[model samples]
Every structure is written in structure tokens, then in C-alpha cells.
Target: MNQSDEVEITLQVCDPKIIAGLNKFIVYTIKGMDKNGQFDIQRRFSDFKTIRSFLLTKWPGCYIPPVPPRKAFGNLEQQFIDERRLMLEDFLKKIATLKYLWYSEEFQVFLKTPGEIEKALLSVPKITNEEIINKYQDAFSDLSGREINREIIQKINDFKAYIQKISPMVQNFKQIAKNIAEAKSSFQASLIHFITVFIPEYENNVLLEYVEQKERLIFANLIQNEDAQGLINQYCDLLKEPKFQELYQEVRKEGKQLKAFLETFAEREKYESQKANAESRQKELQLELQEVLAGKTTIRTLFSKGKKEDHITKLQQQIADVGKEIESYQFICDILTVLVGYVEIDKFKMEKQFQYYNMIKNIISYEINLSKIAEEFWSKVLKSENMQQQQ
Candidate 1:
């Protein structure tokens, strides 16, 4: 164990400050301590993203968790800055748990450095089969360090495709619940405005105005919706965990291992892009060699064939080498993905559904509850008025 390695670490993100420059940006205060002692450093979102890129390159197919998605707009707002701060803080803490990542010299530098750490970290070297096994011997217990191959890569591809297909629909169901809550608030607002303001102005009867005022107060209290709109909207806002909150709590939540496993796709995408470029370059070299060979048999053209032929052969070999690396990396990725499918993510009940219909049921039940509250309020108000008239 290296003396510099962080066996114990504590982290907190704070002091989100927005920099007003030619281009606006935000930075966070990351306070952390390990064996190396405590340090406070300021880092930007792009800096965190850069570290992710570095990790992906060095440890392809490793389970690197994601930070929050970058937002070009609305990022300067204090709320967004705080949310991002929490996410970045979470990302760093996860990395700290993995000795392969957190204890590395590169990662140590990244934590203390404020800006781009690209020059500080080693450039990613070409990967070897042995290196893959060495990095993962302890990373995932489920991997078992078994042999991996191209066929498993195909399995990973197919599995990821299926997940991607279902992702939108799962997200849409949650969004719909949010939308329903929003619509309830909108309707609640419109009804209150009609009863309190517009109707009171036109009706012009003292008794009617007095009754409407009470009605307005009731509806206003219904949400206190005037102050703010949160997840659980509408008259049900009175409930601790109303329909929306119930649905939010009930639905699917991703486990850390599953989240980590899914993020490897970004690493895979890089190799896919590299292979595509190599293949394209090979084609271009072949065409150039042909043109050189096709020229009239002159001294200059004839002599060029040897060089052109060698270049084409070299290009072809380069493409094949890239293909092999892609295969090896995909094998690693497959092992990680399977860990999630078979055992890793089961720790979180990753198989749960989105609870769409359940959300609808909650909404309907909330409406029923609202009806009861409205009746109770009206009944009490009228009883008080009748007692006043009898007196």
C-alpha cells in the first residue's frame, strides 16, 4: 500500500460561487481528507467532466459513476449551482471508494488541482489483455476474472440497446406524474381566481361577496400553492406524501452498481469512434495506392509503388490492430455489464417497474380526499352563518 493512497477519505461540496467572466461559470469548494491530510480546492463542472474522460480512457469499461448532466443554460442560478454541487460531491465520493481509481497518482493530483489536469495525468497508453485482468481482480467480485470475448460484447450491445429503448418510456411515466401534479395546481389556481377576484367584482352582493371570500380563503389554504409549487401539487399539498410524492417514492431507483455499469458505454463509444476512423483511413490509403500504381510505367511512378504498397500494408495492419483492441475492451465491458445484470444491481432491486398505473390511482384517490375536505369546510362555514341568523 502506497503512503499517498487514500485509505480513508471524507468529502463535502460547498461555497458554490459563480465566476463572472467573458463566459460565466460556476466553481465549488471540495473539502477532503485522506492519509495525505485535508485539502480544500475549487473545481468547475468541466474539470469534473475532464476527470471522467481521463478515467474512461485509462480504465475503459470500469464502473465509473456519472455526475449530473451539464446544462449550458440556467447553470448560473443558485439552485442549479447547489444541485450540481451535490452531484459533483457524490461523484467524487464514489470514486474515493474504488482504490484502483482513488489511490492512483493521477486521481490524487486531480483532487488537489483546480483546472484541467490533463497534463498532470499520464496520457492513456495502449491497453493489453493482462492489464485488463489486473485492474479488475477486485473491482467487481462477480467478474470472477473469467475469460471474456467478442460474443459477450455482442450480449452487452444487445442488453444496452434494450435498456436504451425502455429508458424514454420509463422517464415519460415519471414526467407524466409531474405533469398531472402541475395541471392540478393550474386548475386549482384558475378556480380560486374565478371565485375570489373576477366573480366577487361582478356579483356585487354583500352576502355573496362574503361567502366567496371565505371560499377563496379555503382554496388558497388548499395549496398554500401561492407560495411555491413543489413535486406534490394541488389541494393534496396538505398531505405529507400526496399522490406525486407517493409516486416519486414508489417508482424505480437505480442502484450504484447499475449506474456505474451503464456509464461504461461512454468508454465504449470512444473505441467505436477510433475504430471507425481507422477503417476510414485504411480505405483512403488503399485508393491512394491504387492511383499511384495506375500511373504510366515511368521511372518516377514505378519507383513509387514500393513505398505506396508498404504504406497501404501498414494502414491495413493498423486497422486490424484497432479492431483487436476494440474486441479486448468490449470483453472487459461485457464482464462489467454482466456483473450488473446477474448480481451487482440486484442489491437495489433494479428489476422494479415505473409504477405508471399506480400513479394514476394515487391521483384519483387524492381527488376523492379533496372532495371530502371541501365538503367539510363548506358544511362548517354554513352552520356558523345559520347560527348568526338565528341569534
Candidate 2:
């Protein structure tokens, strides 16, 4: 038969009790076969020949012995059933492991659900027993969602314990990292300031003046660069002083600001980019409004032929369409304005008293406030009659 026409056969023994019985029978058959005899033709032949020779020499007229049964004669069907049962058990164990692993939080978040697993399984043409085992092994090592979750909880507990046990030490380390970072920043700032201000004032004597009047007002202003080498030197000197050292020690007792500082620094770039985009969008909206107003100026020419009903209807439809467009733009603009703290609403041609105008403002305000932590700004804007009366 052609490969396509060939029928695929599979056994579907569903009863758990029957499966258990088959497994037991197979195990017993295997054990019995093992105990029956070793399958070594060479050894058997040697023993048989030696016995025959001895019998012939010791007592004339000895008969030859018959051959033993082959290993397959023990219990072939039972062995087959046992092997199948073992294979099925292994398969089930692997699937169970996968299920447990997939349910784990980490894995679940990535895989989403059991349906994903089913989909993946269905995508393949056919999965062999060996392939399934191999996949299970491969997937198990990385299936750390449960372990990761447990570790996360344990880590939180450990962190809390650590805080309780050596909070002072932890604080000290934090302060040290913070101090180092701050010192580095201050040193840089001081260098800039020195180059910009003090260096010019003192000229050749700048370094000398800085060192001599380290505690002076002018030097303090110059050394605000937290990363300046000169500032770091001054900090070390301050550490030598009893009063300053005591203050430094007390500050060290406070928790470090390293995490806070690093987090802020990391977000700075994203915040700046968002701010720039908001500003650009605001400008674009203003230009668009100018264009709309300029276009509205031409509306008077179109209406120069007395207010005909048809003309009025067309104008009204056009106005409505423009109003809808304005509403959409305003929605976007409002969000930008709220994020950036200002929006230029005068760009659109819709009158302040227009219903659409109020609708746009209200919708924008609602959406912006929904996203914001504080709604005071949005609330005040919505409360104004200027937007309401315009509609």
C-alpha cells in the first residue's frame, strides 16, 4: 500500500484496573524469565559435551541430553504488556511534569495557558515516545516558574530578615554607594564650576585657593559637582575632622539612596524623550489649528451668494465633518496637554460655544484624568463654563 493509504493502528486500553493487571503480569513474566536460566549457548554446549564424555568414559552406554527451551518461551505476551505499561507510565509522568511546570507563575505568564501547549502539540506532524521524553527533559530545566515563585517569596523573606538583622550595615553599604556616586557627581560639577567661575577668578591660584578655603562659601559653590576629584579630597579631609566625621557617621547610619538614585537615572532618558514628543505634538496641533482657521476665512467667499438652503445644508455638513475631525485631534491634544501641563485649544475653527467643542474638551478631560494620578487639573478644566457654553 502507498504510505498515504496505510492504516495507522493504535491500542486504546482505557481501564485503569486492566492496565494495572497487565503491568503486574508483565513484571512477573520478566522476573520469571530472568530466573529460568542464562541464555549462553557456548556454556551449555561445553557442559553438555563434558558430561557426555564423562558418562561415556565412566559408564558405557550414556544418552545425550535434550536442549532447553528458548528465552522467548517464558512469557512473550506478558512481557509485551509490561513494556507497554512502563512506556505509558513514563509518558504520563513526563506529561504531568510538563503540566505542573506550565502552571507555574513564571511559565504561565509567558505561555499564557494550557491551550498554548495544546496548540504547540497540534502544530507538529507526529510526536514519538522518545521525542516526547526528550522534549520533556529539555523543557523541564527551564520550567522554573514554580521554583522562581518560591524563590521570589523566599527572597522577600530573606530580604526582610536581612533588613531586621543588619539593617544598620545594609544602610551603611547603601550610604557608601550613594556617597561614592554623589561624590563622583559632585566632583564633576565642581570641576565644571571651577573651570567656569573659580578658575577664572583665581587664575593661577585657583587650586591653592580651593584647598585653602575648602570650607568657604565660594569653594562650597564650586565643589557642588558631586564627582569632582578635588571635592572628594575635601570630603576625605572633612572625614578627618571630629565634628564632620561624626556627622558623616550619622549620615551613614541612614539608609543608602543608591537604588533610588539609579532608578531615577534610568528613567531620566525615557522621561526626556516623552517630554520632547509631547512638545513636538503640541506644536504640530497648533500649526494644524492655524491651517483650519485660515481655511475658515475662505468659507465667507463660498457663502457670498446669499444664504440658500442647499448652500447652508452643505456648509453645515462640512462644518459637522470638520467638527468631528477637530474632536479627534482635540482628544489627542488634550492627552498631550495634560501630560505636558498645557494645550493650545485656539488652533481649531470650532467656536468655544459649539457643542462639539465642549464634547471634545469633556472627553479629553475625562480620558486624561483617567490616566493621571491626580484629577484636580482635569476637574477644574471641566468645571469651567467656557467649554460648556461654547458647546
Judged by TM-score, which candidate is best? Answer: 1
Candidate 2 at residue 102, lDDT? 23
lDDT of 1 by residue, 1-391 (tens): 5566535788898998888999988888889788777878887888787888777666775656666776778888885687578678867887877767886656777887655666656544555655754666555554575555665556667666866776666566656766765565577667556644654455445444665654433323333344322322433344433345445323322332334456666565665565566556656555654665565344444565566567556656765675666566555555555554444334323323324455567778776787776565445434544334545
- Candidate lDDT scores, in order, read 0.60, 0.35
Model 1, C-alpha of 339: deviation from truth (Å): 5.3
lDDT, candidate 1, at 105: 52
How close to the true structure is residue 283 of candidate 2, measured as C-alpha lDDT?
A: 60
Provide the TM-score for each candidate, comma-separated.
0.55, 0.16
339-382 per-residue lDDT for model 2 (tens digits): 11111112111222353455456546644543351243234334
Q: Clashing residue pairs in candidate 1, if any?
A: none
> Which has the greatest lDDT?
1
Per-candidate clashes come to 0, 26
